[model samples]
Target: MTSAQVEKGSEHTSEEGYERGLGSRQVQMIAIGGAIGVGLFLNAGANIAKAGPSLILMYAVAGVIIFFIMRALGELLLYRPVSGSFAEYSREFLGPFFGYFTGWTYWLLWVVTGMAELTAAAIYIHYWFPDVPQWASALGFLVVLFVANLISVKLFGEIEFWFSMIKVTALIGMIVIGLGVLTFGFSAAGDTAAVSNLWAFDGFFPKGIGSSLMTLQGVMFAYLAVELVGVTAGESENPEKTLPKAINTLPWRIGLFYVGALTVILCVVKWTEFAPGVSPFVKAFAMIGIPAGAGIVNFVVLTAALSSCNSGMYSTGRMLRTLADSGEAPKAFNKLSVTKTPALAITVSVLFMGIGVVLNYIVPEKAFGYVVSVATAAGIWTWLMILISHVRYRRAVEAGRLPASSFPAPGGSKGSYVAIVFLLFVTGLIAYDSESRVCLYVMAGWAVALGIGWAVLKARNPQIAERREPEFEKV
Candidate 1:
């Protein structure tokens, strides 16, 4: 059925026909889980090694840009919440081509992102069961999470709520422990837990500002899924209150988790002590004399990976359903199961993610790095489209086309314009790095393929190209 089949005056809109089971608590927790992922728990050691303590500054600066991006997205959500999120907005504000491309690209983005998460999950598993093959662990974890996601979106939210709670609790513990070590000059971290560690080893920018800028792409990648909170507005029981609250609290989340945790870790251990592939959390726990430190941290990182993969499943399903409902994907994907969940869409996404298991067997150690670079580059595209779409949306509002958003972006269209420039700068950094250069190449191919697919879709279904935007309140 085309999404136009949605009954009028029902809570279910044509674009978001699924049940709105995501309550306020679930929405808030999911928003938190979206930002705190395997990136900080597993990959941050590498970022710290690359940029020194300056890594904290990179995260702060990147967090501000991300907040602006979310504000733009929040404004759009208040205007018209939908499960399709950015893709739907792009279709309405930009064109059918952009809308179609955004949906597919975002789907691909998560497919690859889930693979990365699985790869990292398996590695974290190895910390406990050294004998377990990475592929076996990857497969095991995938199957478990897949089952969890299939049951219901409520289950997905509950799982994520707990997953994020664990991560947040751990970070809070670390911050407290680190602060204790710093002030008392005693505790598990040894006498080395001095505040001077921020600039002690080789000054704050030990690797120099140039080195830090070079790592901005990776730092930004850590923030890839942060916008996911906006995507849940459709399912959220109360987006007006939940979304603005989530977006508004972003600065503190960035401050406490990324900035606070990193400060504690760096102050306790010298930057040189962090290994490229190892998690700094593990190192800090071990240094502080926590028993079974690696094992404890291994569990945390595992959940972090689980958190990301779980989110990937949730989003890809909603996105595919959005496409199918719009007549842009196979009609089968539009079918909802007993729980009003998009089961078929979720199943297809899971099957595709199984490719990560094979890659894990092929090159287990390097799999995360490869998948992350591409995901990051794809993420940059996703964020850019959101800001651009919001700019056009704002113009529509001003022209008396749609109502002024209740949750308008702080700086309005100009904020979106500035965020656009920052994202472009990050894109440049991705291109400048030789190791990360393949993402640009792959993105180009993906864009061209999407362009051709859009043309064929338009030819087959002319109505898709001539879709009329649904009317909303006038300013």
Candidate 2:
């Protein structure tokens, strides 16, 4: 296959209707913003408590796996940049059923993730307004973000750019302040703040290697939306340049935001001092005696939650539209509004995300935990599909059946295989942990449901069930 053939094959599909409103800056920020969300803001404290300083090692390992997965995705994106992303590759490489499953599962992933974010946002709001109902706060945020998404893709990009900017800026500030405490002993925690705090209490692996391994599930959850960058290919101003740059910077982002920030915080305030159900950054600030520091951190986390939920609305709409164009979902989702946005799809997805508000009402205490587990399960499936599809694409390229991706992943198919095994290991850990095991059960039910839906779609339109050859193969 020649470069001409690859370029021809990369032409827009059903995603052509989208406006290329997301610029390089917005895409870059989106990639950065997606990596820092409620998972790190509110959930890391629990992980730290469970793994001690070993949590840093777990994050580093998971970050490497995530980097491998993104490289695989980056190769495919450069091959065929589309809003459908992994779902499109899955259909071409795996089969139509796999594509359908990946599309709907990804859609399901963000919906539940939005629920978890809303739950977290409500919790953050409680720090400022303790008397307010969690459900009410969740509903308010849901409506605001829903409106922002309905307007236009450009608006969505701007909102996400600022949301992510706040998160990145606050995290950098936190790390700097943490360093100050450790270096000069300028704050209240200064005397106690030292690098030795990591191993001083109960050693680095305080709860044993088994307990530290259990935290991988949550760590992977924190990295869930990092692939959202792939979904923006159709809307990006320049997919080839912007997508690769976005993916290449992922390692450093993970290093600084997750590993570096956590190391600094744990150094200042011992892993044991951090508790579940609280933001470790907030706790570190409070311990350092920064006046109103906890309040400021709470506000930052609230934005983080909203940012993820906003992204959920954006990606779910696009995924639903992709499924609709492929005849796997309702046709109504195939239409775009005057602004060239998937208005109906966005509306339907937001309505489902409202289930989070109901969960907050009925199970406020458990809403965050329940939704996070389910989101992580769905996310694992999506990442596996990307890795598997990449492996298949590489095989096709090696066999002279398809042209190679311009941005080929390092180690070719080997990185994908490693990432796949790592994901499966995380899945096994999910099953081994009693609390997170419920997510696997939930995913089982979800699979059965998607299977039934596919059978009905197949019965209605046999063409939708047929596995088509890749466009390059047809040439």
lDDT per residue (tens digit) for residues 27-93 in model 2: 9999999999999999999999899999999999999999999999999998878899999999998
TM-score of model 1 relative to the true fold? 0.95
Clash pairs, model 2 backbone: none
**Model 1, global lDDT:** 0.84
Local distance difference test scores for all models: 0.84, 0.93
Return the number of clashes found in candidate 2: 0
lDDT of 1 by residue, 1-475 (tens): 1122222312543345667778888888888878888788878988898889999999898888888899999998877767788998888888887888889989988999999899989888777788999999999999999999889878999999999998888778878877887888665666777778889888999989988998788877788788888678667776667888988888899889998899888988888889777889888888888678657777887898899999999999989998998888999999998887899999999999999999999988888888888898889889999999999989988898677877898878898898899989888888889898898899899989888888898789888897446545221
lDDT of 1 at 387: 97
Clashes of each: 0, 0
lDDT measured at residue 380 in model 2 versus the true structure, 0 to 100: 96
Give per-model TM-scores: 0.95, 0.97
